[model samples]
Target: MSMRFGSRRQGRLAGAGVLAAATAGAALVAAPTAHAASVHVVTPGQSIQQAVDASRPGDIVQIMPGTYQESVLVNVPRLTIQGAGAQRVILKPPAAATAQGGAPKASTPDTPSTAGAASTPDTPSTADNAADVTPATTANPCFTTGTGICVAGTEGHRLKGVRIQGLTVTGFATYGVAATETDHLVVAGVNASGNKLYGIGEQKSVRAVFVRNHAADNGEAGIFLANTTQEEAGALDLDGARVSGNVLTGNTMGVVLRRVRDMDVLRNSVTGNCAGMFVIGDENTPRGGDLTIRDNEVSANTKYCAPNSHLPFVQGAGIVLTGVENTVVERNRIEGNVGTSQMSGGVVLFKSFVGVPNTGNTVRDNMLSGNAPADLADRDTAGKDNTFTGNSCSISQPAGRC
Candidate 1:
């Protein structure tokens, strides 16, 4: 028994020594040290791809002043490629020059070689270059700014620290800036207009931030967001976005947000658009919860034809709400461009979904006047679980709560 106790004590002492050594080692390794890396300067002929390839996951790519008329794909994350400013680094679309990489690939993506497509000179233009992207002809191309269509697979992606500030993004093969399956994206001081689908289509759970940007004169909705699938249950914090101080104008539907949750919209000006702002939810299956639409001044959002885009008329609704729940729309000044002959609905609460009613929403203190609200294709709910008060409405006409 004595020997056994001695052996047990020895084993405990050995374990304690191992634990002490591990803790000490962890302390030494996990000390609060700054792990800073040097930035790589991308010069002429040195592409962002090359800089990124040379970087080790955490390095910053500082692009100097130049027009990089090349498309790029970033599969890596956690790296910062910051231009000197919005004006410095210009990211253009990938064209035939880069695509028909006929010869053997280069050692580094940034290396300029006269042997292959890198040797080709870039002909730069403006957003009008899409008309020139035919298969047979290669026109002097420009970046897709201010507008375009959203492609099939690239609906949502993250774009951060990228500045098209005064530049335009239009005529995309897809949406100007599609942000789906993306998160924590920051788009500031950029101008996105005249795209095929939407200026921005945020799908899935993208916690995006749009500040000091202009989304105007686009083909379809200015900013459109669709919800994710049902497998992502309890995706509550999936997105908590903020859109502030932005201008949206002259689109099919302006700033249309569908199937999202927990948004903070403040101090933005909406004007001269088809529908100033459209907010709705996913009615078919599971919808989002906990949305806050407040402090936005929505006015002068006029109406027109589908207007240079291929979208349907049913897709246009200013401040339109569908099968949404647990929302608040308050304190917004809604006026002007209420209705014309073609465009209707200043703000619409359309419970047109087949199954459930868009319930549990509260709207208060919104100066909802001078706009034509959507006449329900039909009506069922007698304002249950939804409170509408403190809103200045016209009790006579069918517009603005009349």
Candidate 2:
């Protein structure tokens, strides 16, 4: 799919105020002063982790145009990790580790029992079988944690205002970039590919922005966002988090949003995946909803994915919404997604696995074609007050919906 959609122009304008404020905050931290933050430059054969560890808060770690083999952890708030460019700066696992594991490839999803034993199916697991030789320790958590870049903060002390941009991270066992308990985090202009699990993942975060990135050929979702990774909980109010202008392809699913609220999924190009997008909720205290999904191109997602413990086999699913309420899906172009799975369609509204029905959701004004079974499928007979209107499509499951 081409990433040159004009939707990005409108999407940028929609979030201009918030993005500008964030840029201003970052500038103040980067300004020269008595205790001025320094810029640490790392070149080929140098250690990115060492530079990160040696830097103070608000410092910029600038990586030159070269390949570096190491896992980096950024825990300092208001820090910026800038690379020369995604095409120029490359980050991968160490040569020894690569030799042992024989390079990462897109593989079938592992079963829950053999996968990350402590993690839920909807989240990235900690089991890094590919990098099992490097065990995780207090000092090098990113090594065995199976993450190329990790930005972590404790629940009691959320990391704030960290920016990671202009890099290509690949060949990890798990996520290309993982962040937890972070606020105002920005990940932009990165390419995340060939990871065993999710390309980019974030949990327990608020006001996060993922923009202008490319994610492809990952084992699981291109981008995974959730309330929590390890435990079941109520939905988190994302406080205006945004996923905009990204290109996602060749993963099991393009983007998976689980138990999150108040976010925007806008202007993304999603294609050639098993499923385009999944908006998932369950029987939690506060149900997930109140989000906007708009202006994206979702097409040709026909790759078949086998069923895991939490979900049925998924294929040809343009946008699947389960157990969500008050969500708006509008102005998207969905086409050429064909499959036999129950969830397959241009836009599907199915009941949650826990039998929770969708309520008060709206699907309108979308352009859809060539979707098998139906362009719009409302399989949740028990769902309440869900409306489908102004959609331009050929067919729908219960008839007269198009």
**When superposed on Cα atoms, how far off is each prediction in RMSD?**
18.7, 4.7
Q: Please write out the lDDT profile of model 2 over residues 1-402, one tens digit for every residue.
A: 222324553344334434544674568656654467788999999888888888887788989999988778889888888887766788887675687764444233422112112333333334434442232212433323667888888777889988888778888777789888899898887788878788888888899999877888888889988887666688899999999988888999999888889999999989999999988777786988899999999999999988876457888999988888999999999999889998899999988767888899999999999998789999999899999999999999999899
* Location of the lowest summed lDDT over 10 successive residues in candidate 1: 106-115
Per-residue CA lDDT of model 1 for 1-402, tens digit only, reads: 011113433343334334433443354355432454557888757776666657543455666766554433333343444444333344444444225431111111100011111122211223434332333213211112211211112334443222112233443433556543455555554455655446665555456666655666665566665553212222234357877776677766667665567777776777777666655444334565467778787776665553322222432334555556778878877665456333344455555333345588877787766554342111324334866668775531233343
Best by lDDT: 2
Model 2 lDDT on a 0 to 1 scale = 0.80
lDDT of 1: 0.49
C-alpha lDDT values of all predictions: 0.49, 0.80
What TM-score fits each model?
Answer: 0.64, 0.87
Clashes in model 2: which pairs? none
Off by over 4 Å in 2: 1-26, 29-34, 103-144
